[model samples]
Target: MPRSKRDKKVSLTKTDRKGLAWKQRIIDDIRFCVEKYPNIFVFQVQNMRNNLLKDLRQEWKKNSRFIFGKNRIMQIGLGRTKAEETETDLHKLSKRLTGQVGLLFTEKTKKEVLEWAENYWAVEYARSGFVATKTVTLPAGPLEEFTHSMEPHLRSLGLPTKLEKGVVTIYSDYTVCEEGKVLTPEQARILKLLGDPMAKFRLTMKCSWTKKDGFELHVEDSVDDNQSDSAMEEEPEDDDEKEEMEGDDE
Candidate 1:
């Protein structure tokens, strides 16, 4: 007889079963996170998982949560009804999670979390000593608006900027300032500040005004009532001086 078909089937060993169980446990943890947090960010990284985790724990211990897991498991977790039914969205987002993904969660506002991410990117870029990405020029109007929008936030970080020939330039002696462009130093510093630079800029621009009606105006320099009285008192002294002068002449 030929080799039995049952002999051809590969059975899962005890170790394989145990590994499967551990993976399931991690999936459960991910599901719990999806249900618990409202805002989630998916990050794509390469060869820096351990370092990223360390940096996150050290820098954002109080406000951040991180999880790494299989994309399918994460998508299923995101779909859970206990959460907001984000399965479809997760599926779309999972495309970028192929290489190595580290999900970031925060109890802080979304703005704060994104700001932190931007700062992290800045540090990472500095460590590599190069631009990890290329720049694309936006339309002129939008670029102008964006520059104006970020001005005050830069100012708050003490990184004043000026518009020169349609380019935003940072003002600092320690860092090289170039005409017709915002420099890398300025961009890095702005990211390090970790807030909506545009929002702060808008607020600062709005603050450049006072009420036109002058409701609270006050004057401090009024003539004193004692001025006439002092002049009257001086008249007698002047007459006495005049009489002395006449006597001296006589």
Candidate 2:
């Protein structure tokens, strides 16, 4: 059904403002990095944690700048289409902007960047409703983390619990989650409470560019070139990308 005149006006006004602001921000970000940094890299991230990314930024802050934004804006920053716009042939790097991508601006050499990838990773706790990567079992024992008052709550979640000598004790071993299965809400909460981390942080270098060289591509053994290299093959190369990768960027 078509919208009434009033509804259309309200929707258009609110959406247009946000859309324009986002585009302008992308343009400014790309321009700033291109003007200041000598090298540009397009990298992919998986299962990334915001705190971890911030830590990485701090680690490389003295020499590098990182931007995770609209891919087109990032592409434009590296001179996506108009080669003459940027000092370097950043347009070439735009071809590999696939998946959860971000740009790294730095004077660091390609070798240094690749070397850093070797050790750049972190592990984090998984949230509820996420699929378990591995089986998680809470063996029958006294759950010291839980107070005696939690015994009743734990029992409601299917854990056979009882208070024993002021400690929350389990009556039998319980399988909290199975590998490749969606984690129950209770399981996720318990895992977090147990301080178990299941999320692995990782980054990948898809391609890099410099003023002298157009783009130097790096392929990881685990990635399939046909698929990985062609992630944006079907995505339109214009400034009018309709959707953006969001939520968990990895």
Candidate 3:
């Protein structure tokens, strides 16, 4: 039996409607995020966006899912629920979020995200020649021990430090190893490549067995007074004629 034309048309319309509804549901989810999350950080990748997109695509390929949605839709989606409670005021965050944005929805920890941000900023800082204004305090310890532990790593990175007022101060210009000592362009490049001066120093000390190397050797344990005396006694007698001739020449 042949189906009626009206029945076929009605069935096709129902299928089309269902498809459109599903599409709208996804878009609404994205819109909620954009509207509610005032702290949405818009990283302006610009030229680098393609690289990020490629990485995301690769990850999606492996995981069989990815999120690439319209900003407006995400803004609306964020407003649907309180994604994360914040101590910062919403007004301040809203001002910061007014621009292009790419959403990153992940299960990764905040620390992991912060670490990635730090590494990214490190590269940016190197290219722009920027230094952090923050200073970290170190606990009390032996000056010689501290210097020995840190100096080699700093030297390797071409960054110089000095013990001033019982604290290690990094030179104003990272290009120089000693304070007020100008560094060549190559030195600055090396220092930039070495990121985080303190981390590098700690790693170097641990790898190089600096603690053992820095331990002081006692004179009594290392050498005998009798041996020293015998060695001193073996010194040759001064040739008086030769000494007089040398003195006259001088």
Among all candidates shown, the one with the greatest lDDT: 2
Cα deviation at 37, candidate 1, in Å, is 1.5
- TM-score between candidate 2 and the true structure: 0.71
> Which number leads on TM-score?
2
What stretches of model 1 exceed 4 Å from their correct place? 1-18, 46-49, 80-90, 122-250
Note each model's CA RMSD in angstroms: 34.1, 7.6, 34.4
Superposed by TM-score, candidate 2 places the C-alpha of residue 198 at a distance from the truth, in angstroms, of 2.4
Per-candidate Cα lDDT values, in order, are 0.40, 0.70, 0.32
Clashes of each: 0, 1, 17
Q: What stretches of model 3 exceed 4 Å from their correct place?
A: 1-25, 28-48, 60-68, 80-97, 120-250
lDDT of 2 by residue, 11-84 (tens): 55545543666777666766776777778888887775666767777777777877776666665556545434
Residue range 1-250, candidate 1, lDDT tens digits: 7987778755556435325565566556655655555555665543243454555555655555566555444444443222334332433233233334545544555556545544543223221222424332222222243455566665565554656675555544322222344435555454434321221100000000011211111112232323432232211122111100000000
**Span of 10 residues, lowest total lDDT, candidate 1:** 200-209
TM-score of each: 0.37, 0.71, 0.27
lDDT score at residue 43, model 2, on the 0-100 scale: 81
